[model samples]
Target chain A: MKLRPSSLFLGLAFLICGCTEVTQIGTSVGVASGTITQGQAQSIKRSAAAVEKTFQDITPEQEYYIGRSVAATILTTYKPFDQEAATRYVNLIGQTLGQASGRPETFGGYHFAIMDTDEINAFAAPGGLILISRGLLRCCRNEDALAAVLAHEVSHVERQHGLKAIKAGRLTNAALVVGTEVAKNLTTQELAEATKAFEGTINDIFSTLVNSGYSRSTEFEADATAVNTLRRVGYNPEGLVDMLQEMQKRLKPGSHGFGSTHPAPKDRIDAVRKILGKPVSIVDQPVRKQRFAAALSKI
Target chain B: MMRKWLVVLGLLLVPSAVALAVNARMIVQVQRGQIRATPSYLASVLATVPYGVSVEILQTKGEWMQVKSLQGQVGWMHKSALTTKAVPMSSGSTTAKTGATSDELALAGKGFNSDIEREFKAKNKNLNFAAVDRMERIKISPAEMQVFLQTGAVKPLEGGVQ
Candidate 1:
C-alpha cells in the first residue's frame, strides 16, 4: 500500500502537536505504505523531539527550583534584614501587590524579603522570590510608594524577565538534551551533563541581575506594568513616580545597586509620568501613611 | 488488507479531530482567580475558578478571554490566568483519555528541576540556601491581607470604604 499525501500531511500535523504516539504510528504507517521515505520519518521524529525549545517551556516546578537557587546566590551577597516587624510589613505589602499582578500564582508562590543592604535595589527572581533593599524601603513615603516598588518587581517576575535574560542558545541546547528525560531517573552521565546546563542557566541569570542590567526597554516596560498593577490594586500609580523622584535625589550616576542596574532615575520618572497621564484620582488614605511610618520606624 | 486501510484512515482522522477539539478548551492555570463580568479587573466577579478547571474559550479581547465555565456561566478572564491545553474532561478519571501526550510530560519534566538544583548545590557550596528557606517561610495570611487592604482602602474587599 502506498502512503497518501493527505496521510503524510496529517502525520506532520500530529508531530507538530507533539503527540508522540500518534506521530510514531503515523511515521510507521507512512513507512510501511512507502508514502514517506525512512529519512523523512527520522527527520520528523527529530523535529518532534525539538518541541520544547523555548523559555516558555520551563515548567513551574523547574522555575521554582531555579528561583530557589538564584535567591540563595543573591543572599550570599546581601544579608536578610534582621528587623522582624519591618520584614513582615514588606512581605505583606509585597504579597498583596503580587496577588493583584497578572501572573499571581507561581509554583512556590510569591515570597518577598527585605535585604539588609541600603543599596537602593530590588530583585525579582523567577518563581516569585522578590528582594528589596532596606535603602530602597527608606525611599517610600507611604504604603502606596512601597506597593509601587513591589508591583514593579512583581511585573518583572510576571514578565519572566529573569528567565528571558538567559542566553537562548544555552536554553535550547539544554532543552534538546534534557528533553523529557527529567521524568525518569537519570544515569550518572546524564546527570552530569544536566548539571553543567544548570550551572550555565544560573550564571546567565546571575550576571544579568548583578552585572549586566536588563535592557532599557525592558526597564521601561516594568515601570509601565508597575503603574498598571498599582492602579489595579487600588493604590495610587503616582507613588511609582514619587519613589523614582526620591531615588533621583539620593542616587548619583555611579552609585551602587539600583542606580547602576537601572536606567537613570530621571528617565524612569519621565516614562512613568507619561504612563500615568494628567493626575487622575488616587485613593490615598491617611491611615495608609500612618501604617507605613509605624512599620518603618525601626529602620 | 481491510485492517491496513482502517489503520491508515484512523491515523489521518484522529489527529486532526483531536487538534480541533483541543484548541477550544482552556484550563485555569492560576491557583484561584475570578471570572469577572467584564474584561477589566475592576469588573465584578461572576464566578471564582480554581486551577485546572476547564473553560471553553468563547472570544478574546486583548489580554482577556471570554470563557464559559462547566456550569455554563460566561465571564471574562485574563489570558494569563488560563492555559490553552485541554485538561481531562473527567476530573477524577485518571486513565489516558486526557489527550495529554508523553511528549508533553517529557517537556514538562525537562529543565532545571529539584534534582538539578541538588547537583548544583553540591558543586557550589557557598550558595546560601538558608536565607532562601527563611524568606520562603515568611508568609502573610489571608486575614492579615484583608485587614491591610481594609485599613489601606484598597479595592475588591467586600466592605471597607471602597
Candidate 2:
C-alpha cells in the first residue's frame, strides 16, 4: 500500500519532534510507502543527519585546522617580528579585547602575531590566528589605538567573514561526499577528492583574507563591531576614530595593504563617527601610553 | 492498526521526554574561557574553564550562557565559548562508545584533523607550518591576563560595563 502525503508529513513531524526511534519509524514509513526501499530511506536519514553543507557546518576544530594552514601560508610571505616583547604585548591586548568581545573563544583559542612586513595590513584567519603588520602597529599612536586595530581583526573572525567567502557549491560537494562515506577510514580515492575540496576551502579563505579583501560592507561591519568591542573592554571607542584619522593622513596613491583592501579612510572615519553618534575625546592615559611605548621600544 | 499508531506516538514522546529530562550540557570548545559572575564580560570571573570541560547550562541571555561547572561553581560564559555537541569524556577511553552520530563526529574534528594537515603540508612544501606552530606556542596564561588587567586598569576589573 502506498503511504499518503499526509502520512509522510506526520512522519516528518515525528522526526522534528525528536523521536528516539527515528530509524525504525523511517524504515516503517519506507516499507509502507512501497515507493522506496528501507535501505534508501535509512541512507537518506543518515545523510540528512551527517552532512555539513555550509560555512556554519564547519566545526570549530575544522576551522582551527584550516586556520593553521592559512596562517602557515601567510607566514611564507612574511617573517615573524623578532621582538618577543612586542609580540607578547599585542597578544595581551588582543586577548583582553577577545575576552570582552561577544566571541571570546575559538577552537584553538585566539593567537596574535606580528608580521615583520612594513605593509599596513592585518588578517584574521578562520580559527583565531590574527597577524598584524609592524606597519599597522606604527600607525597606532597609543595602546588604545592599537587595541582598536586588533578589535577590528577580531570582529572579522567573530563574524566568520573569511569562512563565508568560500563558494557554496564547494561546501555542498564536500558535505555530500563526507556524509555518504560510512567507513571509519576513507579509501584512497575518497581521501583524494576530500583533500581537493579541503584545499579549495583553504584557498577561498586565503584569497578573501589576504589577497582580495572582504566587501566594503563587511569592513564597515568589522569597524562597527570593533567600536563595540573597544567600548566593552574599557578602551575608548574614539581610538578607532584616531586610528582611522592616522590612516587617512598616511594614505597615498597606489598604497597596498589596508589602503588597497578597504574603502577610503575618510569614509571609514565618517562611518565610525556616525556610529558613535558624538565626538569622542581620546583617553590616552599616561600609564597606557608608557606601556605602549615600552613594548615598541625594541622595534 | 491502533497498536502501531500507539507505538509511533510512544516513539515520538520518548525522545522529547528524554530531551527534557537531561539538563542541557555544553562543552567548552575554546582553548580556555572565564566563567563570569554575571552575564556581562565586565563581571568578576568566578572560575576558569578549559577546553572539553562539560558544564550544565543553567540559562541563556542574548549571547551569554549561565553554566554550572562540575565543582558546583556557577557563572556566565559566552555562547560562542561552548558547543552543544558531546565529546568523548576521558581521553584514554578511546573505544568507549561516545554515542555521538556521524554528523556530530564530522563537526567535532573527527575526519578533518592533523592527518589531513600533514597530507596537505606534504603536498605544499612552501607552506610554513613551522611558523604557525611557533605562533601557537605564544600563549598568555589567565594569571598573566589578570595581572595585565590589574596593572592596566582594564575593564571586567575596573568597574562598570560599557
Candidate 3:
C-alpha cells in the first residue's frame, strides 16, 4: 500500500474535498494529513462555526462605523474643545504614541479629540477614535505623562475592548440580517432589524465606558500595556506611575468620571510598579518638558 | 486498477490546484491602506489600495507583509489590513453575485455598515456626527510626525514595525 508523495498529496486533497461544508476543509486537511486528531478536528469545526456570528466576526470597516456612532454619542455629552493649537499638540503626541502601539493603524485610522468637560476620564472607542477630557489632560505633569495617558487609551483601542462589551445575543441578531445566504442589498425589514441591533450594540459599549467601568483586570492590563508603549516610544516608563500618583491626589472617591470608570489610582500604580520590577528613574528632558508647557499652558 | 486510480487522481488535481492558488491570495480588508516602500510605517507610500483588492504576498518582516498587486506594484503593508479570506464587494443595495462562497458573501458589507448608520442617524437626530467627521479629518502627516518625534527626542520603537 506504499504510495508516492504525489499520490499521498492527492489522497489528502481527496479527503479535504470530501468535506461537504467549505468551512470544514481546514479540519479535514489536518485530519487527512495526520496532523490533528479527529476529536480536535471536530472541536476546531465547532469553534469556527461558533465564531461566525460573534464579535470576532465584526469587520474593521464595521468597527469603524460603530466607533463613529460611539464618538458622536460622546460628543453629545461633552463638547469638543475648540482650541486649535492645543488640539494639534495633543494629536501629535497621541499619533506618536499610536505609532508605538502594536496595532498602530486601524481601518478608519487613529483620531484624537479633546472634550470640553473637565471630567478626569478618556474614552477609546473601537477603530481608534480617542476622546480625552480636559480634566484628564490637566492631570498630566509633563509631556511624558501625557504620553502615558494617551498610551493607556490607545491600548484600549488596540485590544478592541469596546467591542467586547457587545452582548453575544445582539451580535448574533445583527449577523442574522446579513447572514451567509443574503449578500445582496438588504430588504427594508432587514435594514430595520440591523438598525435596532446597531443601537443596542452602541448602548452596550457606551454603558460600560461611561457609567459602569471595565473589570479591574482590564484596567490593570491597560496600565501594564501603557508602560510598554511609553518605554517603546522613548519616554520614561515611570511617567505612568507619576501620572497615577498625581491622579491619587485629584480623584475624589465614589465620584463620577474616572472615579466611576476606572480603578483606584493607588492600585493602578502598584500594579504598574510590579511590572517595572525596579524603579524607573525619570530622566530630565528639557525639550519634552518645555513643549509640554507651551502646548498645554493655556488650557 | 492502477490506471483507474491514476485517472481519479488526475481528475482531482485540476480543481485542487486551482483551490490552492486561490488560497494563496491575500485580500485587502481595510477601507484604504498605503503600500509603503519599506516595512516601516515611516516609509514612503508606494500605492494606496482599496478594500476587496487582492494581492500576492512576496515576503514578510516583523508585523509587515510585502505584497505585489495585480497591477504589478510591489510594496509592504501592515498585516492588520489584510486577510486570507475572500472579500465580496457589493455596489450599494445590489445583490453581489460574483461567485463568492458563503463565508465570503457573509463577510460582505453587512451588519453595522453605512446604511445602518444612516438609518440610526435618521431615528436619533441629537448625536453630533459633525464633530466625529471633524475628528476623523485631523490627520498628522508622516512628515509632521517625523519632525515631532525628532524635536521631542522620541525614539522609534526598537526592532518593531512602526
Instruction: Kindly list the per-residue Cα lDDT of model 2 for residues B9-33, writing each as its tens digit.
Output: 9999975575466569888766556
Order of the predicted models by lDDT, top scorer first:
3, 2, 1
Reference-based lDDT, each prediction: 0.75, 0.76, 0.79
| Candidate 1 chain B: 10-residue stretch with minimal lDDT | B86-95
Scored against the native two-chain complex, candidate 2 gets a DockQ of 0.29
Model 1 Cα lDDT, one tens digit per residue, B30-61? 44546888776445668866545678777677
- Candidate 1 CAPRI level: acceptable
Instruction: Please write out the lDDT profile of model 2 over residues A181-250, one tens digit for every residue.
Output: 2325555665666677789989998887777888999999999999888877778888888888887777
**Candidate 1 lDDT by residue in tens digits, A1-299:** 99767687776777676587777777877798787899999878766656646677775556777889888999889988867788888888888777668876576668888888878888889989999998998888778788889999999999999999878766654554455432356667767777787788888998899877899999999989987777667788888888888988888678778878899989998888787788654456888777788889866
Per-candidate fnat, comma-separated: 0.56, 0.52, 0.69
- Chain B only: TM-score of model 2: 0.53
Each prediction's number of clashing residue pairs: 1, 0, 1
Q: What digit string (tens of lDDT, one per residue) describes model 3 on residues A1-299?
A: 86755456656766776533544666666688787799998776655554567677787878888999999999999999978888898899888777668886687788899999867989999999999989888889988888899999999988889999888778755766544333467889878888988999999999999989798999988888888887777777788888888888888888788998898999898899899888867765788788888888877
Q: List the residue pairs that clash in candidate 3.
A: A184-B95
Tell me the deviation in Å of residue A196 in model 1: 1.5
Alpha-carbon lDDT of model 3: 0.79
- For candidate 2, give the lDDT of residue A71: 89
Task: Compute the interface RMSD for candidate 2.
Answer: 3.5
Better of 2 and 3 by lDDT: 3
lDDT of 2 at B32: 59
TM-score of each: 0.73, 0.80, 0.80
> Weakest 10 consecutive residues, lDDT, candidate 3 chain A?
A175-184
